[model samples]
Target: MGGYCGYLATVGGLAAGADAAYIYEEPFDIRDLQSNVKHLTEKMKTSIQRGLVLRNENCSENYTTDFIYQLYSEEGKGVFDCRKNVLGHMQQGGAPSPFDRNFGTKIAAKAMQWISKKLKEFYREGHVFANSEDSACLLGMRRRALVFQPVIQLKDETDFVHRIPKEQWWLRLRPLMKILAKYKTSYDVSDSGQLEHIRVSSPW
Candidate 1:
């Protein structure tokens, strides 16, 4: 979920040429994380069994009891108790914020404009193309959308080929590797409590 949010935030920032980014993560402690992970892993394994039992019984009371039992056994009593006051209904009751409504309208307008422009460009290129039924292909709003043709074979032979030159690959990877090394060193120090053992290596 963090990764997905990060990706969306990055794309939105890049599209708007924003100066900075903000990030958020699910609130959790080390113990909470461990408990959640263990519970989820075990629950997944028995999910099919529970589903089958619920289907066979076909009673709301039995299904509810089984679900509570599963949650209590795996995630402990806190989660089980909390489930009693579930916020499922409250989540759907809020009014749409002004920002959300404005953003939605803006995105729709931009999508229509982009699709119209792409259609015009495609026709002007004198390339024989059939109208696509797929909204995604017809819309041409994908990441790096303008860099490729609709035909897969043609796309591969055109600008898509060698888009990343050797120098470009090295330029991207160098800083990423450096950051990874720094993180590794920091992690080692945190784990062993040995500040002197941490060493930095130059990439030259």
Candidate 2:
């Protein structure tokens, strides 16, 4: 589930009375989405038996959340009420968050320093123009620390086909989210000798 906040919306679902959240990164599969909806509807039935009501607000690619709600509505007929909440480009056109403003300022200052140093090196070498790996670099945080990575050097770490980074830092937190949300999964070996995870019903 995606939009301005992307996968963060799934994390926020906990506050909206979600028992668990299923997140799919880039290259989302329709099959997986359908499976997740089936499982979620089953869980909702269990919740209804426990005298609990649920509402959801998922964010993602345009109309993706709407599709999800529609699936729930169809599956949960006479079981629970499901509806879509449109936010109109949710949280868009607002001033940048305080943390964003501060972090951006820091990165800009560091980039300026790098540019000044590069200029000084060019002047010392008596070069009319400079073209090097350092000449074109990206300035930003890596693992909570500011880092400068040359664009040319990121080829091995870039997924050109998907137009995204191969190593996404936040993906590591997904498993933690499942754990905190009480998603109990068990692995089973298939006939083809492949292991697959089977989700167990959660009491939440």
Candidate 3:
């Protein structure tokens, strides 16, 4: 948990809460950073206002668009009407990419394999083996196999760190997305839309 927290902070910044939100939302690895930047930049260029609003709303659970609105409004930033620009249901109507399908399959397979192994281990340990007559024991077995029971479930121990705030994370990485767009990095849809290169020429 300590290690995971540090990794989250290093990857997504402190704005990501201690929860597993970083796994789904924040860029935790170099590959993730590159992929995320490419996706975000493309979205921004196609629809800057909409993209920015989505990012603001979903960047972190703790730091919301409302929080930003209040903070900036106090400093004379005018009210932003998100309703007009919101895509709403349109965002959910996209086909799943090959990457999504492949990754989902892989995770499902791994989870099933883990569950099988855990059940075997539990049986070998000679824990009270209730027969088919015992539905409660069967349910307990399922729970033990499928549930993620951490060795230490303390409140202070989280799977995310607090190195950079969420807002700062967005500020720093958003430019990288713009740079990728400006350079026209290849985005092959079939190949999981990976960025082919991010070449930076030295000014020397």
Candidate closest to the true structure, highest lDDT = 2
Winner on TM-score between 2 and 3 is: 2
What would the TM-scores of all predictions be?
0.28, 0.64, 0.33
Look at candidate 3 and tell me the lDDT of residue 57: 30
Off by over 4 Å in 2: 1-66, 85-89, 124-128, 184-204
RMSD values for the candidates in order, in angstroms, are 15.8, 6.3, 13.1
Compare candidates 2 and 3 on lDDT and give the better one: 2
Summarize candidate 1's per-residue lDDT along 1-204 as a digit string, tens digits. Answer: 122123333333344432222222112233533433343344345522121110111122233434644644565433223223222235343678997697667667777776777667557466635466332342222353323234543343343332321122112222232233222222223332322343444332
The parts of candidate 3 lying over 4 Å away from their true place are: 1-55, 58-83, 124-172, 178-204
**lDDT value, residue 65 of candidate 2:** 56
lDDT of each: 0.35, 0.57, 0.37
Candidate 2 or 1, higher lDDT: 2
Model 1 scores what on Cα lDDT? 0.35
Q: Which residue pairs show collisions in model 2?
A: 2-59, 2-60, 3-60
Q: What is the lDDT of residue 138 in candidate 1?
A: 21
- Displacement of the residue 65 alpha carbon in candidate 2, Å: 4.9
